[model samples]
Target chain A: MVNRMILANVLHRPIRTAVSVLAVAIEVGMVMLVVGLCHGLVNESAKRVEGVGADILVQPPQSSFLFGLSQAPMPMKVGERLEEIPHVLAVTPVLFVVNSVANLSVIYGVDMTSFDRVSGGFVYHAGGPFQAPYDILVDDVYAKANRVKVGQTLNLLSHEFRVAGIVEHGKGARLFIPLATAEDLQGVQDRASIFFVKCTDPAYGDDAAQAIHKLLPKHSVLPIKDYLSLMTSNNLPGLNYFISAMIAIAVAIGFLVIFLSMYTTITERTREIGILKSLGASKRYIIANILREATLLAAVGILAGYGGSLIARRAILAAFPTLSVELTWDWRFYAASLALIGSLLGAFYPALRAAQLDPVDALAYE
Target chain B: MEPIISTKGLKKIFRIGKVDVPALRGVDLRVQEGEFVAVVGPSGCGKSTLLHVLGGLTSPTEGHVLVDGNDFRGMSDADRTRFRRHKIGFVFQRYNLLPTLTARHNISIATHIQGNGFNPHRFQAVTSMLGITEKLEHRPYALSGGEQQRVAIARAVICEPKILLADEPTGNLDTENSQIVLDMMRELNRTFRQTILMITHNLEAAAVADRIIRMRDGRIISD
Candidate 1:
């Protein structure tokens, strides 16, 4: 009976039903795209951090300055002191500077030997480890995107570095120069922004993080996973505000459409309801009929919305590859929640009108 | 035989500002089991009001309605709905078939609402008996007035209610369609022993009934 009723209602008003479905689909698609982009950003950033494979990352108290804009570099002397602590094993210094890719190359600088110790071995394919002051490695994705070749000299801030080999690291960006070259260009002799520490035993990761925290109370010592999560949450506040605003607007529009559609449906059916009541159909049956129609519309809208999300993901990816958004099934939560809300809100007025109709008055409406 | 439906001094009043207009004024009526009865009157004559009160669709301000000896005045609103669903069937003049459902599904809905599973053979039998078997799969919009009314009749009688209440069951039909509907109602009464109470303004429509009651000015002027 429900199936028959739903089919009937859908068939009766194709234009209205299609419009409702499109509204829901757009909402679902928006939510899917938003969630997918956020997830992608977090995943990519974490891959960069994990590429270093550090048990714990130790940075200067002022190192957070790199989070937003360029700042005075942290002194490299901090890495030396942190390595002297007991059971430290080894510490690799890290330098930070946003190098622009003009013409065709992205340049990053890091200490070649210490970087290898920290990562066990840099996952590289074309170029061997950094051997010269200007030697650097570019990952395959960046190389392909930029159309650059090995042994290429890229100028950055008046310094030229040799791209010794093309390297492929798991989702990490390219290295334009070795650590020494970056320090030389920045003119900071004793300071670097971060230290990547390798514990003698992987099980000692937490202990190492705690020890670093105790050693340098002013600086935050974060485990690899926690650091990645912190980085992911950094942009969450702004994203949350944006999402809340968009969702509120979407909900308002959804309700307005639903209200108008349901109102028209009831108004059109007033005479028919009278006829049913006169035939011995109770108010309960009438209300059920209206609600059943709303539910049917909602279900169709949700399915279309879900499908729209897939289309949205593909479109976004095609338009902006750098957005790096990957679609996932987790987005269904938003679709389901919004769909239920839409159906309930849409059905309320129609149900009330159907239930409260006076058979005599309704029949006289014609 | 005792009355299947009995109403005594049933009064329904509508309030407009400071004045109260009576719709059913001290009405007394009884419908015997298996009887085909019609209450006839002009527009605004309270004939429909009397039918509503008898069918438990509306409450009277000042009287009692006893259905199969059960006092409707004592039943709760939910109980009244339940009683209406189980003991009463309704046929409307405009043939209020849900525009979405096919004729067969329309009738099946009533039985489904009664929480009974679909019985294909029974539905086919009912439609065939009404000579609407060919149009059973057609939606209300696709069927003619007479076909739609037959589907309405099938919907009303599918649950096999103890009493069928109709309001202007043939008022929207032509004379030919009206006669067909009346013939169906007569067959239902004679073959199924179903008690029927109908309201109509047409005297010719009322002529098909076993008994006719007339109303005027919210009161029964003749029976």
Candidate 2:
């Protein structure tokens, strides 16, 4: 019967209940989307780097692990010296340039022969590799997202280029331009931003990386697996703090809305409290009733948020093929726990106040 | 049998702001088991306060009230709540039913609060006795003044508490509904031997009880 009363009470004010549920859902959704996007971008970038088949990565001094974000190029002579390191089978010097046009993209400038020697050559889906200085190759995901064909003309970075081929995704960057054409466009001749080194044996990557560090002490040389680990949210600069701030904002929104809703409900239902007390309801009973109602609302909110985030993730990936959003079970559990704990804390004061109301005064309330 | 309820020099003072205003002053009372007694008085004459104190809804300023052999003065608030759950039932003016619940649920909630769960047998008999078996499916807003009060009465007695305390059960009812509710109470007392302590200002409502105690100035003037 107490359960019946609780259900009846929750359903009594439909508009209020909906607003409370929606508030909590929004909070959960915000937290899920933020975390998903952060982890997704990091993991996807790491996977693409691993796909390049480079056993060791050589970057310029003070450069970010994010290749596209760094524009400072090292001398091409550095690539020649890197190839001389013991156990290094091949070295591919590539220029990383950021193209901020209709979308922010990283255009890889590569010498096709050496790039293929270091990383296995691109798997073409349509046409062949670039044949002219103005020619470009796009990955399949980019092709599908922009509806580009092998013969399509594209204008990027204020320069016109024809799409020579569509290649399979997960090779370093979305758009590929020849090394000479990239240097010509940037006016930085004979310079490369990163060196991708393939070792004779995959197990000898650490030795190759240690040799490169000794050769170029100022540059960052990391084994592929170690570099991938550095790309996670916790290891990335400022990302963990950003995620924490977003989660705090979501929790605050949930807390304030639940608190106000429950407090107003208690005040409006003062007479009802009196009736329950008159029916021999204990203080613990009253507190439990309010808390249980809040818990039910939070539970529904979590389910909605989980479903909403999944749908949103799919829609986002569809709209932007190169983008990824990962919604893992661990984060889902965390979001649910955060929302439940926030809602319970929000309802605590109101529950206590309701329990403390004098039966005589509550009954006399207008 | 000893009186099921006994109050000696019962006093209840309501402090409004700075002044000490007394609602019940040195009132002594007794009601035997299975007796239907009426407490009648004018407005602010402490009859309602007396009912509230007897029902354990409020504490007395200075007095002792023993109901079913349990001394209320020595009992904590939790103890009083437990005692009220098992030993007493209350019917109020204005029907005081949880408007959100159906009549049946509102009536059955008493049994639920007592932690005995629902009693289908007692519920069927009690609703049948009150002539509200058909109206149990409706909410309080859909019921008439008399129907709501009857539902409240059923709720009060569904658990078979030792004493039923009613504060003007018919104060809001029309003539026909008032007579029907009073007759039902009288029938409930005779059939179930239910002990009823009803507080009211209506002489006609008090006429249905076996005895009437009248009060004035917060003290019993006559019995």
Candidate 3:
């Protein structure tokens, strides 16, 4: 009966309930979207790292952020020296440059023969491998999104190149060209971005990395597994703080909305509360009633927020294909739990006020 | 027989912006078990204040209230709340039924507040006696004034409290509805041996009680 009363009370004030639910939904949706994007980023970065299929990666010391993008160019001759290391089967030098023309596109320049050897080679979906100096390969997703097909000419860094082939999804970069061509175009002929070193045996990766680190102590030599772990753990600078701030904002939004709504509701029901007290309702009973209402509202809001977030993810990916938004179950659960906690906290003060009202005065209240 | 309620020198002062206005002044009163006592007075005569104090809804400024031999003055606020839930039931002039709940739910909530589940037999007996069984599904707004007041009375007595406190339970009803509510209270008192303390300005309403006490300016003028 008390539960029914709570449900009835929520339905009695439609506008207030709607506003509260909408506020919670918005907060949950924001958290879902932000966390989803964060997960997507982590997943995409890990996939890119693993895609290299390298036992060890050597890059300039400071390039530990964003998959070595921040690193200064290392000398291409580092690959030749790494090839001299024991248990090192192949060494491929690659350059990565971010071009901001029609959104950010990562351009990778790789030595095709050594890249295929070190990175298990790519599976072509259309056309054939790079045939000319300026030939390029675009991944399936990017090719379809941008409407680029085989034999089509596309511009990167104000230089035009024919799309030589289409690679399988998650193969490598959206745009891959010959190593010398990218170096010449970027005016860094003798510089390479990073070196991918494949060990003769999988178990020798850690040993090979340690040996390379000894030779070039000024640079970072990390096994591929360690780099992937770093990305998944969100140890990157500013990333953890950014995620924490987004979660805090989401919680605040949920808290403030529920607080205002429940507070006003308790104020409006002051006389009713007084009557309930007169009839022998304890403070715990009153608080339980208020909390039950809040929980119901949060439950509805979470369901709606989950649906809205899924739709938002679809819309976001539709508009910006490059921006990955992964709506994973873990992120959704986190959003729901945070929203529930926030709303319950928000309703606490109002429930306490309701329970503390003087029954005599409340009954006499007009 | 032991007195179900007793108050000695009960005083209640209202501080209106630092001005001490006395609402109850050294009033002594007692009602025995199973007694139906009516307190009658003009407005601002502290009739309601005395009822509130006796019901444990408010504390006296300087007095001792003993209900069923339990000293109310010594009990904490939380203790008083628990005491009221277990021992007292109240009917308000406004028919303080939860507007959002059905008549049945409003009555059932009284039991729920007691931390005891509903007793189907007691529910049937009360609703049947009050003639509210058919109207149980209707919310308060859909009920007539007489029906709403009856539902309120039913809610008050559903838990079989030792004492029932009523503050002008018929103030909002028409003459016919008022009489019906009064008769229900009289019937409840007679049938269940329930003790009742009612505050009212209506002499006819007071006449239905076993005894009437009149108050003037916060003191009992006559009994």
- lDDT value, residue A142 of candidate 3: 83
Interface RMSD of each: 2.7, 0.9, 0.9
Instruction: Report the Cα lDDT for residue A240, model 3.
Output: 78
Model 2 regions more than 4 Å off: none
Q: Can you give the lDDT of residue B172 in candidate 1? A: 87
For residues A181-243, what per-residue lDDT tens digits would candidate 2 score against the true structure? 989987898899999999999999988888899999999898998898888999888999999
Q: Give me the runs in candidate 3 sitting further than 4 Å from their true place.
A: A65-72
- How far in Å is the alpha carbon of A45 misplaced in model 1? 0.4
Each prediction's TM-score against the native? 0.86, 0.95, 0.96
Give one digit per residue, the lDDT tens place, for model 1 in A28-103: 6666666677778667656766787777877766555223243565677778877877667888776665665553
lDDT tens digits, residue span A1-366, model 3? 767788889999999999889888888899889878877867786786678788888888878646435556888888899999999999998888777887765778988899999888988889878899889888887887888899999888788889999987664566789888878877787778888899999899989998999999988888988877777536767777888898899889899999999999998999999989998788888899999999999999999899889899999888877678888888788889999999999999999999999998888777
Superior candidate under lDDT, 1 versus 3: 3
Which of 1 and 3 is the better model by TM-score?
3
Ranking by lDDT: 2, 3, 1
**CA lDDT of B207 in candidate 3?**
95
Expressed as tens digits, the lDDT of each residue in B1-223 for candidate 1 is: 7899888898999888999999988989888999999999889999877777776677778998888877977776556667766777878777778777888888988887666567777777678778898888888889989889999999988888899989899988999988988998898888888799999999998998999999999998888
For each candidate in the order shown, give its overall lDDT on alpha carbons. 0.74, 0.91, 0.87
lDDT of 3 by residue, B19-113 (tens): 99999998988899999999999999999888888888888899878998889877888888888888898888888888998998999889988
Lowest lDDT sum, 10 consecutive residues, model 3 chain A, at: A63-72
